[model samples]
Target chain A: MKRVLIAAALSTTALTATSAAAQTEIEFWHDKTGRLGELLKEQVATFNGMQSDYVVVESQKGNYSEVLNAGIAAFRAGEQPDILLVFEVGTATMMAAEGAIKPVYEVMAEAGADFDADGFIGAVKGYYTTNDGQMLSMPYNSSTPVLWVNRDKLQEAGINPDVDLSTWQNVGDVLDQLKAAGVDCPMTTAWQSWVHLENLSAYHDVPFATKENGFSGTDTELAFNGPVQVQHISTMGEWARDGKFIYAGRRNEGGANFRGGDCALFTESSAGYAGINAEAKFEFEVRPLPYWEGVDGAPMNTIIGGASLWVLAGQTDEEYKGVAEFLNFLSSPEIQAKWHQDTGYLPITSAAGDLTREQGFYDENPGTDIAVIQMTANQPTANSKGLRLGSFDQIRGIIDEELEAVWSGDKTAQAALDSAAERGNALLRRFEQATR
Target chain B: MEKRVRFKGLWLPLLLVMPQLLITAVFFFYPAGQAIWQSLFIPDPFGLSMRYVGLGNFEFLLSDPFYRASFVTTAVFSILVTLVSMGVALYLAVLADRLIKGSGTYRTLLIWPYAVAPAVAGVLWLFMFNTRVGVVTWYLGVLGYDWNHVLNQGEAMGLVVVASAWGRISYNFLFFLAGLQAIPRSVIEAAAIDGARFWTRFRTIVFPLLSPTTFFLLVVNIVYAFFETFGVIHTITSGGPQQATTILVYKVYADGFVGQDLGSSAAQSVILLVIVGILTIIQFKYIERRVHY
Candidate 1:
């Protein structure tokens, strides 16, 4: 009789636990920490409060590459989350994993959620879309490279803080003056390959790779060793030799130097504004990225960096419905505008941009709209639409090595770029084979 | 007379050793077999499909100049790390053994670094040597010396090597100290009464007595330098400035995890395993002859 009573009690407890969890749970794994992480949690709480049928549980994985690796491993083990945030470079890898992901368009359509494909900015949307205009991932925090200026440093060098630096020629003059004035670090850049090679080709309206930068097919060849690219790299190499340019690292290690008021000029992502605003003690300004004056159709459009949200496969239908709803909530104009104003990431949708402008965010923060204007100044050419190539992360490593050789005066610009192209092409061919 | 305990039956002996055999099979053999099998094929990102390439992965790696250069880099790195770490540990152990008072405090302070994880050790070193904001870099600048390891291959390699060897000295010190304490003191006292100085006595008596510990440490340190030290290389240099410090193990991690090229990484591990096997055989065959025990 006592055993029967204990079994009944256990059954009652299990039933209550199941009943309390009636809301369908959707798991979201992202690579954000600190302030961004806290903001994401707040957004999730607001969403859960507004709804009754679903709850989104968000988790912070490691950095970009780590998150991609973890997602792939989880998929293989049949334990993947419902949503993952993959970096821009991993687009090709994710797209190739057909059965591993559920495209955002299909998820939105099947769930009948309010998603507008046309609402997104062209350059931002084009990066994560198929050739047929179907969206693959939900565009999130997109950012473009811009030039950051230390106004006090410029003034200390007896130069105007508002000097025109629209052209590389003008920037070169400034660099020479800064060097002459005994500035140790006149100019330094983060994301060397992205800013100097990939986006430089896009801004100059030249091909970075064949087959429309790998949008049409997988058999694309690297063309970044062209004369224009070589000329640009040669100029930078000369600057390095003269101590006018500092190469801190392959990634954003230069951010600290720039924020510490050591560098007069910095070329970094627009997303750097958050950290610089928080840490920099001196006044600073944001300016459009400079382009060479001689190139035709120059300063065309810069490509996007940062990441997007991708829905994974193998979740229950109810879970996918919750994912679609949460994504819709995130892309709403109020939410997106708030995120853009808080984090300095691009407002991905037109409505969000308009809402931000109407709310006086751009007026209050001068020079913050440079990235948007730079990206939307002209229709993106075939080259400016951004890259879609497999093994891009590895190719970037090769580029970094070659660029370092040039910076250290071990190799000429043309020689280093040629070698980089050769090595990068070999990897591309290997990727082509592996996917085939 | 020799005393031995004999098992009653084969079943009892086999049963007694079953747990160890099972653990070895599960932990070592299973993963090794997986690596060997996976080395022959390239799988898709989702692992939904695998394409067999036979010896193609090996062929690619062998032909790649970067991969070939890593072999030399790994050799140089392992040799330098083993020599520096072991040499320093032996010297410190000798000093500590000679201490008549406060030896325990000195020994405890020396052993503290061994408790730090390799990655944490790497981060600490990186902070002190950071180019833009490092304290050491600032001090060097005040002395009219410029230090930028990001673009300097030699400096990057030196920094990573020093950091890798720094944490390992404590581990080697423990063994050397134990070996020194185990040595009988009567022989040394006799040598002293015979008018032998400290250096002469150490060279003729104590040095030979510590040969077994040195030999054991030599083998272990080589293995440690080869397979471990990935964290230090990763955090400090990341195999950068033209792949100057791209050791073999770091390459395995970069390719397999970051690059998602599993087949090549697996093939490289197989080659590494074979190389280590050959090295162990050589050490046992030739180097063992000089060891006293």
Candidate 2:
């Protein structure tokens, strides 16, 4: 009689808890921490408040690599969250994971969610799409590299505030002038290899790899150590030797140096916007990443840097419906516009950009629109759609090492490039064989 | 006679040792077995690729010039850091042992660094070593050290070795200090009474007594230099300036996690294991055998 009473009480408690929870909780895993983290929480609250059946619970994973690693581990363990934020580079890897991910288009169509692929910026959209434009992921926090200038430091060095440095040639003169005027640090770059090599390749309309920079196929070869690449790297090496371009450690160790107002010019991702905006006491401006004027087809559009939200496979129809609805809510113009304005990430859609413009947010913040402009200014060639090689993250490390060698005067540009290409291509071939 | 008979009995021995034996086989041998197996197979990032080619990863590593170069660098790094740290730790431990006043405080303070997490230590070292805003860099500039790890290969290696030693020295010092305390004062007093000076007493008496500790430290420090230094190195130099300090473990991480060449990375790990195994065997067979204690 006592055991039956206990069982009845337990059932009553479970029923009450279920009634309290009424809504289905969908899990969201992202790499945002601190301010961006807070913004996401706010967004989640807004969505939950608007809905009666779904509650999106957001979790803060670690930085980009940690988040990616966590997601991959979770997927393997069959405990992956409903939505996973995979970086832009990992899009290829995620796409190629046969049944691991359900493309966003399928989910949207199945749930009849309101989404227009045509509303997204072409280049930003292209990075996350197949050649025929089946959107695989939703581009979130899209940013391209740009030149961040400390105008106060430039002024301190007696340089004109309006000095044009749209090209590397002009920047070289500015660097020399800053040096002559005893500027301790004239120019420093973040993601030294990425900003200097990868974007430089795109800016010069050169391919970073063969086979459409690995977008079309697996058997791709690195073409980064080519002549144009060599010249740019050698020039940076000369700058490092000259004390103009300081060799900071990898992983944005120089961000602090730049942030401290010790450096005049910084080449960093547009995603650095939030950090820079918060820290910089001086007047700062964003300009297009300078290209070498001598190169033909110079000043080509830059590619995106931040991650996108990939819809994972192996979910019930209701879960898929939840994902579609959540994504549709995330893509609404009001939400996207606010996200773009708040985080300084590019508004992923034209409608979002138009909303921001109509609201005069762009007028209030001038260079906030530069990332969008840089990414959307041109029609993306196969080469410029962005890299999708199987082992790109590893290849980036090799390029980083080779770039370091150049900076330290250990190797000339051609030597570093040749060796990197040789070594990197070996890995590619091995990757190709292994993947095959 | 009864204990000897029990030791000789298989059932008795097996019952006593089964847990530890099983644990070792399950954990250590299993990982070793898996690493060996993985070295034979290649892994692709996507689930698309899983191919086995016998001895392919090993041959590829052997032929690769970059791996060869980093292997030698790893050797140089491991040896230099182990020796320097052991020497410094021994000296400090001896000095602390001899101090009459505030000895406990000194010992406690010295062990404080050992309590710090390795990840935290890496961050602190990076902050101190940073070129522009680093306090140490400014002081070095004032003192004419010409030190900049990011731009110079030698300096980068120096920074890595120093940071590795700094992170590891406290634990080593603790061991040596404990070993120092274990020695009886009467033996050293006898040496002194025999008109033996400090240097002679240290060399003939104290050094022999500390042999076991030194041997233990040699093996431990070398392993620490190989595995633990990678994080701090990655934080500070990132095997940079010119790939000057990219050691074996850093290469493993870069290849396996970042590069996604799990098979080749396993091959590198296998090679590292073999190299460490050979070194450990040599130490046991030769150096430790010759030690007095």
Give the Cα lDDT of each candidate. 0.91, 0.83
Q: Which fraction of the native contacts appears in each prediction?
A: 0.79, 0.64
Q: TM-scores across all candidates?
A: 0.96, 0.94
Question: What docking tier does model 1 reach?
Answer: medium
lDDT of 1 by residue, B126-172 (tens): 99999988899999999998998999998898888889999999999
For A67-148, candidate 1 gives per-residue lDDT tens digits of: 9998999999998989999999999889888899999999999999989999999999999999999999998889999999
Clashing pairs in 1: none
Considering chain A alone, report the TM-score of candidate 1 relative to the true chain A: 0.96
Query: After best superposition, candidate 1 residue A27: deviation in angstroms?
Result: 0.9
Query: How accurately is candidate 1 docked according to DockQ?
Result: 0.79
**Which regions of candidate 1 are displaced past 4 Å?**
A1-20, B1-13, B193-196
Off by over 4 Å in 2: A1-16, A20-22, B1-8, B46-49
